[model samples]
Target: MNDEQLMRYSRQIMLSELDYDGQVRLTESHALIIGLGGLGSPAALYLAAAGVGTLTLADDDRVDLSNLQRQIAHGEADIDHYKAQSAAESIGAINHHCRTQVITERLQGEALQHAVEHADVVLDCTDRFESRDAINRACVAAGTPLVSGAAIRFSGQLAVFDVRDSAAPCYACLYGDSGDEDQLTCAESGVIAPLVGMIGSYQALEALKLLSGCGTSQKGLSTFDGLSGQWRHFGLGRDPHCPVCQWRR
Candidate 1:
């Protein structure tokens, strides 16, 4: 780390868990964030600020007026811009040293697989179930760790799936291959402004932990009800019939 880097991340380096070595690990890591909306916004921002060496942001949609309500990484000026591009600009503003890459299309098939294979950690901040499934499959195949988060209405969910750990349960183990038609989106049901921030920040926290090896790997589902200000956690186990992770055993 140069003199400027030491000064920039001095606060984080002071921590016992993330002392110089962990901060170095973080600076050597690459994270792939597949979404630039509600959850992806804050996750990317924090990761960039924390000095993740590289970040690849992917999203197919353009920013709209409504996104300003919860997507903190974009501003009014970003309206009509591709979300991946807008987010890259925000990350660059926060940490000039953090390398940023943008994917303006919905990533799938070989493209998504290759992205996951290169990343040290993957964040599934996407809203759609199909995208989440594709990300999970790719991460499992690549033996990478995944940090998944979702928020809609007043409810939010977070989980960490480490394909490197045989005992870890994957996203498919919990939701299976079911279509997400029954799931409600912020566009349909509406979301409280701060709810996305809370969950997205947690996603960043999990990703940092996984990258720096400074904290325990969270191995379950954590759900939050913003309306009631309550949180619940449930341990997850591998599904014997899960097509995505069954072969890992």
Candidate 2:
């Protein structure tokens, strides 16, 4: 919008699909990114770099030595530091234009709902099913668009669930919210470093599309198999019995 912003994002503005208008939209958006680990790392950085105006990063966990292998946002000096704090610092280093808000504690109940309500878009980078379920519910209630990404053991998946659309499927529709399913975490099962980076980048891309209105909102499940280097995508339907989104149907 100004001289500095125009020069900073000149290349992006050059794209006809996402020209000056799209860049302005991105600069006016606010995105909430939950988790600051594997998936959150890249998602946060790219969104900041892509000119998302404001970013709220929430994560209570402190950085561990094990995270450096894949959590690119934190450095060796950040070990034992709160992940959200560390990541906010990293984002500031790259884009002074990006206003970064750090939530150093786990967001729950009213706090979670407030965060989702304030955000123009939400990115579910958390690994736990419980956390994912909670985020999905809050987004559904607030009618906020959500970009969810997951990666474990050389595999990753991405999905966008916009509860604002009556026909769109929420995360709960794709994965039941019962929490009875066996959840394999990256810590327990192990994950390739690049796998999460790839998925997280896609999450950032989807968020930009939703905010800037540059591309069509993607509706479906995209799964990536790192072992075979194959990508499979298929449309996901809203489950009539889905506790989170069934009412909309």
Candidate 3:
């Protein structure tokens, strides 16, 4: 690390668990965040501000006025702009030192698979199950760690599925192909602004832990009910018969 880098990340380096080596690991890591709406906004901001070396942000939608309430990565002026491009600009302004790449097109099929193959860690801040499943499949195939989060109508859930650990479960283990489409989108239900922030921040934290080799990640379902102000967590185990992980085993 250069003198400026040392000074820039001195706070993280101060932690005994994240000394120079750990900080360096973070600086050398790359993260791919799919989706740029509510969850992606804070996740990308925190990661960039923390000096994550490179971030690849993907989203196909344009920024809309409705997004202003929660998508902090965009502004009023960004209305009608591609969200991925807008978010890249937002992150660049926050930390010019961090490399940011924008994928303005939807991540699907081979394109999605290719992105995950190159990332050290992938964040599924996306809003739909189809995208979530695609991301999860790629992560599992690549043996990469994934931190997934979701928020809608005062309810939020976060989980880490690490294919790097043979014993850890993939997302498919928790929600099979039968997962209801109605339950996957934020459009059908409204989300509280701070709920997305809280969950997205946790996603960034988990990504950092996995990247820096620091602490244990939220490697299971961590659910929060903001309306009732209740938080609950549950452990997840790999399905011995899980089709994906089982093949590797």
Going through the candidates in order, what is the number of backbone clashes in each? 0, 0, 0
Ranking by TM-score: 1, 2, 3
Q: Residue 239's C-alpha lDDT in candidate 3?
A: 84
51 Cα displacement, candidate 2 (Å):
0.7
Please write out the lDDT profile of model 1 over residues 67-134, one tens digit for every residue. Answer: 99999999999999999999999998899989998999889999999999999999999888888898
- Per-residue accuracy of model 2 over 79-115 as CA lDDT, tens digit each: 9999999999999999999999999989989999999
Error of 1 at 53 (Å): 0.7
Ten-residue region with minimum lDDT total, candidate 3: 177-186
The collision pairs in model 1 are none
- Which candidate achieves the best TM-score against the true structure? 1
Quote model 1's TM-score: 0.98
Write down the worst ten-residue block by lDDT for model 2.
Answer: 174-183
Query: Would you list the clashing residue pairs of candidate 2?
Result: none
Q: Write the per-residue lDDT of candidate 3 for residues 102-188, one digit (tens) a residue.
A: 898999899999999999999999877878888888999999899999998899999999888878899889987556656646676
TM-score for every candidate vs. truth? 0.98, 0.98, 0.97
TM-score of 2: 0.98
In model 1, which runs have C-alpha deviations exceeding 4 angstroms? none
